[model samples]
Target: MTDQRANWTDEKDATWMTEMIYQVVVLGKRANSGFKKESWQAASSKLNIEHRVNYTKVQLKTRNAEMKKQYAQVSQMNSVLESQRSDACG
Candidate 1:
């Protein structure tokens, strides 16, 4: 059980986790913008095995929330930028 705080610093681990969560959702493990407990547990276990580090369901959930927030922010920024461009070009 190595330090999980260090696990996220590795880009490979972060990318793998993001992809794994997306795959889980695409596979229908997610419901109503949330994932089932077992789904999270499975993701955590798989990541731990693949990355050789310890991670918990809570960590995965937190990361998912953080990623969603970030994505929303980026989307909003892009939308605003597109609107500005439209106004300028109009």
Candidate 2:
């Protein structure tokens, strides 16, 4: 088994990147605000242990930004669908 710190990627590892986004973005839902640096540091540690990959703060931040935009679009679509459903049921 390779050491995670030694086997890091060139910031293009999709699997690692996706998990980073899920960790940081999902954690915000469980808290009152943005994730602290310590929170992400812990997340990186846990992810390294579980996935044998390393994700830096900058990578996680980029993923969070990209996911937030996608989340907003999905949220809007869900809202429209709910409204259509409400109309159909009436």
Candidate 3:
């Protein structure tokens, strides 16, 4: 095994730069958002489509509160996993 700091050198730097350039070119081609305006508009239209439902302010607040609670639970689980990983390694 080699020391972490000692493993880095000019060759590694050049390889990293080449990989980054390749990734950028590939991702740019895959992301057709700039060229496909009609497709983007269609997707947006689909996403923004809503049903006609009359909900009171209190009902909306209750739904928003439930969503926040679910989000916090997921975030806490992620944090626990991250801390466990750091503790196991170090």
Candidate 4:
């Protein structure tokens, strides 16, 4: 049986994974469509080995998608807020 702690990814782990993914994208491993199989494997391996976790590629991919969704939502909200502020000032 796998340890629960090993399976669990906390906030810090998620942030670390995000940073790694950004680095991967910066290095041209990720394209507009998404990560390729080799890139996924590389990111999964790096996270498992360096972060001492046991996340599979699917898990990492799912988490990345979730983070992207959250980021987009936040960005949209910020844009709306800024627009409202401009209207109020104008």
TM-score for each of the candidates: 0.74, 0.54, 0.43, 0.70
**Decreasing TM-score order of the candidates:** 1, 4, 2, 3
Evaluate model 2: give its TM-score.
0.54
How high is the lDDT of residue 4 in model 2?
26
Best by TM-score: 1
Off by over 4 Å in 2: 1-33
TM-score result, candidate 3: 0.43
Each candidate's lDDT (Cα)?
0.71, 0.61, 0.43, 0.69
Candidate 4 residues 1-90, lDDT tens each? 133323445754565566566656676666677666667777677677776667776777676787789899999999999999999999
Off by over 4 Å in 4: 1-27
Q: What are the per-residue Cα lDDT tens digits for candidate 3 across 3-66?
A: 1222324443344334434444654422443323333333223322332223333333343366
TM-score of 1: 0.74
**Candidate 2: residue 66 Cα off by (Å):** 2.7
Could you tell me which residue pairs clash in candidate 1? none
